[model samples]
Target: MKKPIKKQKAVLIILLSNIFIAFLGIGLIIPVMPSFMNIMHLSGSTMGYLVAVFAVAQLLMSPFAGRWVDRYGRKKIIIFGLFLFGVSELIFGVGTNVSVLYISRILGGISAAFIMPGVTAYIADITSVQERAKAMGYISAAISTGFIIGPGIGGFIAEYGVRLPFFFAAAIAFLACFSSIFILKEPLTKEQLAEISAKTKQTNFISDFKRSLNPHYFIAFIIVFVLAFGLSAYETVFSLFSDHKFGFTPKDLAAIITISSIFGVVVQVFMFGKMVDILGEKKMIQLCLIIGAILSVASTVVSNFLGVLLVTCLIFLAFDLLRPALTTFLSKAGGKEQGFVAGMNSAYTSLGNIVGPAMGGILFDVNIHYPYLFAAVILLIGLGITVMWKEKQLAESFAE
Candidate 1:
């Protein structure tokens, strides 16, 4: 028997709401960073350190966050994470110095560690194997929409004050937390929930990680790491790069990110599902690698911000498509290990986030263009990996 449509719709809505709010909070700060740099008297290296610390916290917490999701319940974790996210933003909003800001970022990372893994595993739990990719794509689309709208809203509101976005983000997060508590419902049965929860408490993080490293997932893990590494590396220096290279203002940065993210949303919502159906995960991964490399290089050669925005749109579209496709492949291979696999997926992403910003900061100090140039070269490794790995066949259940 199929799950009821009302319940499916509720799950989808709650998940989408949760994801959109989380990403919007993150994006809400992007357009105001230049102002932040000036007000806080921050250097490129300082910015890099600020960005990296969050990842470090996430990296450390991701493994356990997964375990908690499996052992506890997804709705509990999601609500708690959103509440933490709200508190972190409030910390940023009220902080007087960089020291206080560091505390806020650490909190943000911890929140992400909880929120993302819970969201992914929840989607896997509720969705059928055949529909997982499309479902993931919808989640990605929600994220993209947040990314698209966030900067524009941030830029507009930022005219009042650089820190205004943080307060606004905090309020939005609080709203999400409130909504989640009231609206979200677990999809699992008492027996199923008890079985999953019962088994997880006995396992340690290291042991769970080892179990998660099933050979089938090794390449999936690497793909996430590489993609996050390249993207975060590029992102760390983005504000600095545009400011130095194009003399871009906060508004200019906001416009570019908004346009590109809108394009990303369109591709994920409309194109990603179809592409996954046609090209298959392997071929699609190959294509993202090739395009990602080209765009990383192409971004630097652009004559103006408009040119940069155009290339960025294509790059985001590639990333948005590839993420869901890869997740679909991993979810299919996960057997009953959805929470563990999702946790490892986040762990790898956090690793990339940790390394990418540090590398970007160091390279930016040496030369503003070096980060993007080097990222292009690094992404070629991804292209190579996709060729070397042959994924396991999709489950027979997915044949529908």
Candidate 2:
């Protein structure tokens, strides 16, 4: 007889695969989005709005999605999320109107609200404290791998037509849905269910919401927000920088991003866990932020394509280190209320996404280099906040 699958193994496979497919969809669009907007006759401001709208939708839905995941189960929510994502991708691929594109992004955001928090809580449910960092690293690796391949393929297809990439994205989302439905077994144990129920009985929705709003969590969220904002700005303006300043084609930008993703995947998969253990999450975060800030600053000064590529790689390497450390820390900090904490973390990221591109668009309009400089300053601010913050006090309070 075939042996039953181990719960940890099952959860890891499901989470990683789901994240891979979800990010693959996103990757497919990244290289094509700006040109697609230009084709649709969208103004710069309108394009910013279009990009920000997804984050807005995610922000609005995250709190509820978190609570629902806690109330229900992870597998059901994830499957539903995958379904929604598939539908949204199909809409984006087929729609001709800009308004339809906006609506599609909104729907995609809602799917993200479900997928991200659910996957995080699911990982928390299955992994032990000792194993959490490494497991989270694997998830990050999956995402980075998706980023590596998605844009390259999208850029190739986009050479023919912009809409083709969306159709390709839709196919990927559909594959994720099918995988979740068939391959992902439920991972929750009876003990976990009882624990969740007991916690739910003690806390109301307001209290749950308030838990993540505490000083320590809030500060961590802010750090994530600032970092994400900077990264988003870089993402929004990098293509323009490539085209205008370096005379690089879309394919060239795609190749650069692919290289960054390769570096990111390597760090997250092989180095992040050891770094967290050696330096600790807080110190690791500080180090990453410092390096990222310097890299962002350098990107502004570097005009040559090779120099820009090197700086970009450095920035993404720092980002790769930061992501798993912060996520593992946040998930642990949430303790028994992993769903709520994951939701709040996701909300902070969405807020960053909303703010970053919008700010980048405005800066791009003024001067191409301004966005990277602005991002460097924000990362410096985040570094200051991290240094002064007292983590132990916050952990004690949350423990209560």
Candidate 3:
């Protein structure tokens, strides 16, 4: 048991670092992607499609990846996924055409689908119900740290060339891949391994797939879908808004993302654990949704650069508060089938990703502020769903 615990901690560290590196790769490209597209003379709709393609690919692949993680081991899948991510980044760095960019994003999405669910399941394997929220919060903090650094570094390098950010991202992903190979260990016991194998053998893939689509899991999936849709709207449009409306440079936009990420890290590290303990997952999620909705709406009205920056930070804080609670709730709802649940969550998030940028791009065409208004409405709807979920007691019972 002691050995298991030690291995669990080691796996958590590896997973955290893996998530950080992946986020770094994604974040590094985000601030510069539109500009890069502009340099290539791509249309706004085309850019939106490019972003949507990533989500679409992830959505298509996540269910299978999740099943594989449950049947196979998490460590092998994660390492392989990271290597693929590294290769995708390398391809993006070398390729100049829009077709190449789309292919690269598809590769990245597939890698992400595999990596994220596998890592989350690995965490679920090692952690108790009570410790799960805190663990997830730490993982979220790692992601926040990556977001804080990636944009800054990418923006600095992007001044040289658009491909530089991709190259840097490739380097980071390679580092993460190497780290996973050397430092990560499998966390499953022999019994658990046998059980997973037996289930895979006894149940057909279709049945196993259908079993993963539980209603409780679907409820969590809907919440993630709405949350991600709203967040992605903000993410896709924010830099463009800053540039068009406030005349902010790439560096300035990167700074805003960096500052927002700092706030996110602080909330995830210090406040999320305590919030989960005090308010419980359901109430915490409701509170976060309310706050996030209000702040997201407010972001539209804040015209000045400094004011927008401040509001953006608040929005990130609300997200930080929301994410850990939601993740814990989702994992709990998954119970023994953690990988399938994580995959469903990933698929829903990908669905949101598909919808968010497309909607934001449409609104961006209409008006710069329209996406935030729409996001506010969606988030309000999410709040209502959270209040009406009727599973508060269920969540409390599952808490560690």
TM-score of each: 0.89, 0.89, 0.89
List model 3 lDDT by residue over 1-400, tens digit each: 2333344666677789899899888889876877887788899778767777888999888878877787778888898899999999998888778889889889999999999988898888788776778888987898788877887778789999988899888887888889888887777766776687566544344654466455566556778899889999877888877888889987787678778888889878877878899998888888888888888788877888789889999888887777778888888877666777787778878888888877887899899989888888998999887776776546553652
Residue-level lDDT of model 1, residues 319-373, one tens digit each, is 7787887788777776565677777888899998888878888999999889999
Counting clashing residue pairs in each candidate, in order, gives 0, 0, 2
Tens-digit lDDT string for candidate 2 (28-86): 88778888877888887777677678889998888777776776778888888888888
**Backbone clashes in model 3, listed as residue pairs:** 129-400, 130-400
Residue 102, candidate 2: alpha-carbon lDDT? 91
Residue 360 Cα positional deviation in candidate 3, in Å, after optimal superposition? 2.0
User: Candidate 2 — worst ten consecutive residues by lDDT sum?
Assistant: 1-10
- Give stretches of model 1 more than 4 Å off: 1-7, 34-44, 160-162, 198-205, 242-250, 304-306, 391-400
Best by lDDT: 1
- lDDT values, one for every candidate: 0.82, 0.81, 0.81
With candidate 1 superimposed using the best TM-score fit, by how many Å does residue 312's alpha carbon deviate from the native? 2.2
Candidate 3: list runs displaced more than 4 Å.
1-9, 31-43, 158-162, 200-213, 243-252, 391-400
Model 1: colliding residue pairs: none
